[model samples]
Target: MFDLAEIIDIPPFSLDRQKKGELFTRALSDLTQYHQQNCHEYNQILQLLGGSKNSFSSIEDIPFIPVRLFKEYELLSVDQAEVIKTMTSSGTTGQSVSKIFLDKYTSTNQTKVLTKLVSSFTGKKRLPMLVIDTKAVLKDRNLFSARGAGILGFSMLGYDVTYALDERMELDWEQINAFIQKHKNEQILLFGFTFMIWEHFYKPLQSKGLQLPFENSILIHGGGWKKLIDEAVDNETYKKRIFEVTGIERIFNYYGMVEQTGSIFMECESGYLHSSIFSDVIIRDYKDFRSLGFGEQGLIQLVSLLPQSYPGHSILTEDIGELLGEDNCSCGRLGKYFKVHGRIKNAEIRGCSDTYAEGKK
Candidate 1:
């Protein structure tokens, strides 16, 4: 069995996704076995569920943490000193959420995955990445939130271009225009959350009748349209608006959280978010944990192989998604491509469905 401590301290220097997945599977199985032996909470859950190492033959067998647990528990398997940074969710002012911690190696591995995944998708070695907000917001030490963790983790990828750091996250028109002018011919990558880019940046830019001077510019945003749903935008309208404002063909949406460090499912050209190497996407029926097949929409349960500081072997996300199954992506990546339809309103909220089914594939 591989040592959990060694996995964290050493760099997993593999570029091949399948090989990386093998390493992660083995390492995490060791960690889970270790936790089942050491951590009280983990041990209890395993005992109750009749857990065994054989259960994790595939990613779908991994147990997922309810997103609400972070809000209720300390939720760290490592020592306090080992935590290099803490990130919180940007849900609202008083209702803050926290993701425990990140060690240097964990953070570095996460960045490496981001760079490789994004680079492969955009087909550009490095697009001039424009920061839509402040660097401090990216890696705050204050509270816990998955959104904070995501943005902060992204900032580590040394991107070019001036960052907009207004407290309100409002973009300065002149600065944006000047930056566009400086790299007029370069294909730029604009990154931000769904609401922030839509309400603050896109709308304002479109209203000004201003467009960037690049042909291959792409904008990548995460989170759901729930924030814009209140405004009655809907999915089709939202995508159209993004295309209109960005003036780019490659507008991508990503599905991920702070809990699972490196694995993120990114929206490809075919309008589906493709799963990364470090994780597997399983669509469990809304009420039951039984696995659903392709074209079926249900509660999205992610089995992540990216986490190290915690027991993130499996996490049942509040997001609702549809699995498209394994197929040839036009982008050339193999594996199942899934689309996130939307997220359950709150992390703890459940749908009104019968929990009669319980089967695994």
Candidate 2:
């Protein structure tokens, strides 16, 4: 078993490309064998790809299951009795959702790695948080949708947590203003899915011509950019409009999924999503699934050290992205950083915010 504690102790972005690659290759290779031995379906898939030989010299040598497999099959490396929580991907009325099983070990380490990755940007202290979505999302505890899991996951980084919208997806001005007034002098944190922040929080405030009194606050949002792209909104415009309305200069958009929840690639001041020591992103050719060099856009394959309860260690996602560079970001981070273009065209609209928008239609 590859103990995650060894890498968790290191600073999230401290490992350079060479060092991180060596560690990841070892850890993920071990996880491959671990899953093959414990998960029958995973073993069968590997056997079909080739023989069930798990030894691999490089990260690219490891085979990855399509991310959508979780939607079609129950792929568990651990026994059903060991699952502590099941996380489902966000989907509309008839769309199938991915189900991720988590045991105590996987669950605990997910939080631990997430804390380290987020703290690299937010610092050690937990700030007062105002979530842009309604509190109703967190109602179901055991089976969590990606939206709810996202809310609950990021909520751990803040204190005096508050939701900015009501159950009807209406902006609660009174409550939001009160929260701002109470924490007016402190540095606060705001989180939400990308579209929800735009539709529920930003658009409402913009229409009302209401500016918040958040002198020092950071807004962290993710889920997907499909809805925003439909509106022709780019990252720069999103940040500019948000700054105009809220005066929040520090806004970060992270890239992650329910399958690889904890190992998020957070955006830096340089506007690139960075991979931490515990996780990595590889761009693969759309047709052949071969690894692409930096600056080439293709399907995104995500690998993380946090998924032990299930065979989700390395997954080929439907999203497309291009690797910018490694160990040379202007932000001083020492890992691979890249930009997410969006989901593959004609792919199912399944992001948390995107599904919410579809349901409304």
CA-lDDT, candidates in order? 0.63, 0.91
lDDT of 2 by residue, 1-361 (tens): 7999887789899988788889988899899999999999999999899865657888988889999999999989999999999999998988899999999999999999888889889999999999999998887899999999999999999999999999899988788879978887899999999998999989988998988877588999997677788899999999999998899999999989999989999999999999999899899999898999999999999999999999999999988899999999999999999998878888888788888888888
Query: Distance from true position, residue 85, model 1, in Å?
Result: 1.5
Q: Across residues 1-24, which tens digit of lDDT does each residue of candidate 1 receive?
A: 453343433222222446646765
- Please, what is the TM-score per model? 0.82, 0.98
> Candidate 2: deviation at residue 226, Å?
1.2
What ranges in model 1 sit over 4 Å off? Answer: 1-28, 94-96, 134-145, 345-361
Top lDDT prediction, candidate number: 2
Location of the lowest summed lDDT over 10 successive residues in candidate 1 = 352-361
Q: Per model, how many backbone clashes are there?
A: 12, 0
Model 1 has how many clashing residue pairs? Answer: 12
